[model samples]
Target: MKFIDEYLSDIKDKGLYRELKFFNRPQSKYTSIGNKRMLLMASNNYLDLCNDDRLKDAAEKAIHTYGVGSGGSRLTTGSYELHDQLEKKIAIFKGTEAAILFNTGYMANIGTITAIADKEWIIFSDALNHASIIDGCRLSGAKIVVYKHCDMDDLQEKIKVYKGNKRFIVTDGVFSMDGDIAPLDKIVKLAKENNILTMVDDAHGTGVLGDNGTGCVEYFNLKGQVDIQLGTLSKALASEGGFVAGTKSLVTYLRHKARSFIYSTALSPAMIAVSLCSLDIVKNEKERRVKLLENSKWFQWELRKLGFNVLESNTVIIALVIGNAEKTIKLSEKLFEKGIFISAIRPPTVPEHTSRLRITLMSSHNREELKYVLDKLKEAGMELGII
Candidate 1:
């Protein structure tokens, strides 16, 4: 308890303390917090389909058919017709031979990595991959050689030094915090030349990238080239669950070996129904992603013109770097007071001195709404001497 108190005190002093803010309404571009409507700019609901009537209807219908909870884990009594359909659909969507579901994206990464590798194997991981990926690599007990963030040269050099018969390279397709796309094309090419297997976690890319919105593999035209493709149905798809798409052998292997999938109770029938319906929406509503990306580009440009150091990104995620952790939180608080909700990301979510305001755009957000956000940001930045 004393150590816990000291640790809490240290983080509070360092401006790294985090607390939750409850919302009275559903997660959308605008939601009510304490009965006050706030402009939400920090959500991962990329397509703004969290509150879609179609998804709600689908969930309602499924509830009538399957009731609430999954009776047991998939290997037990949890597997349903909907799960089978979704797995097949996901395989087709991702252009893989087969797919398997996990409780969350974190589970998918950790479960898959530990299942595939061990102490004798080596893993080449990106420096800025999600915590789940990092944890997965650590849990595997493999030699993890971290390369520079999105630097193919570093990856190439490291791969040369870390030679092994059972080796694989893993990276986040779109880094969650940095808002930068990984060079999957170059990484895939490197993997092929080195005879190393490749794994990509496209948690942020699915439903927001590529012509058909299949994710980073399609974005770089590397379908079926990467050995493992991990993704989530919770973000742009506006549902709940994570999955991996790969060859049938890999799928079968995980189904038998992955602990997370074997031990966890399956997602409820209603949630599965929502995921199924949302996938259809993602496939048909191409314009939503187009407009969302367009708005993101313009928003980033405006923030840069106001003297903010915004990271370069092609997706709906925008990282407005503030550098100082305390100031970043202050800026976020100032915006929240102005009726906008943006998250202040700090260490160890990011490296020390690289704190930022991570602004995510929703498809439903129009120019008028974004312009208002920009004006507020400009005022706050000038007041805080951040500009």
Candidate 2:
């Protein structure tokens, strides 16, 4: 406890201390934090389907039919009809021959990476990949090579020297912190030339990118070419699970060999139902994606016009880098006072002196809401001398 307190003090002194903030209701364009109703720019519910009636109806029906929980792992009695159905749907959605479900996106990454690679193999990972991917590579006992963020030349150079029995390349389709798209086309080309297996975690890209919301693989027309596609149900899909979509053989192998999937409890019926409904909505609703993209472009353009640096963001997520962690926190708090709720991302989550306001857009956010948030952001930026 004394060591923990010392560490806490160090974090606090460095301006990296974080505290949990509670929202009293379900995620939406607006959320109630304590007594204050704030514009929710920090949520990952890109499609705003978390509170959608269709998902709610499906969830209620599922609860009535399948009860509250999946009492065992997928290898055991927990493999319900809904679980199977969702996996099949996800496979189809991702343009893969088969799919396997994991309890969370974190488990999916960890399990799949460790299951496939080991001491004999080498893994080439992007420097800016999610923590889950980093942990997975560590657990795999493989030689982990990290290329500079989205630097294909660096990736190619590093991967060329590895003469291992097997080689794997892992990257995020969308970098979560920088809000930039990976050069996946070039990565795929390099992987193909080197006979390397490719895995993309399209957590933020699913239900938002590509034609028909299939994600970055489909967006770049590399659907069948990418060896493995991993995604989350929780972000844009408004659900609670993750899936690995690939060839039938790959799915079968992971189902049998992936420790996380074999040992972890299956996702609940309600969550599965929500993903099913969300997928259907995503497939049918093209307008939402269009509106969301348009909004993101407009917001970023306005921020740039106001002399704020919005670096290379072409998606629903945008980051306004404010340098110092203390200043970033101050800007976030100042904006919060004006009823906007952008999150301040600091060190460990991001590099030191590059702390920022991570602004995310939802399909449900309209022009009026965007204008109001932008106005507050300008005020906050000016007050902090960040613009």
Structural similarity to truth (TM-score) of each candidate: 0.99, 0.99
Give candidate 2 regions above 4 Å deviation: none
Residue 281 miss distance in model 1 (angstroms): 0.5
The lDDT leader among the candidates is: 1
lDDT of every model, 2 decimals? 0.95, 0.92
Writing each residue's lDDT as its tens digit, candidate 1 over 1-387 gives 999999999999999999999998999999978978899999999999999999999999999999999899999999999999999999999999999999899999999999999999999999999999999999999999999999999999998899989999999999999889999999999999999999999999999999999999999999789999999999999999999999999999999988899989999989999999999998998999999998999999888998999999998889999999999999999999999999999999999999999999999999999999999999999999999
Best by the TM-score measure: 1
Q: Which 10 consecutive positions of candidate 2 have the poorest summed lDDT?
A: 156-165
Tens-digit lDDT string for candidate 2 (287-306): 99999999999999999999
Query: Which parts of model 1 are misplaced by more than 4 Å?
Result: none
lDDT of 2 at 180: 95
Alpha carbon lDDT at 86, candidate 1? 96
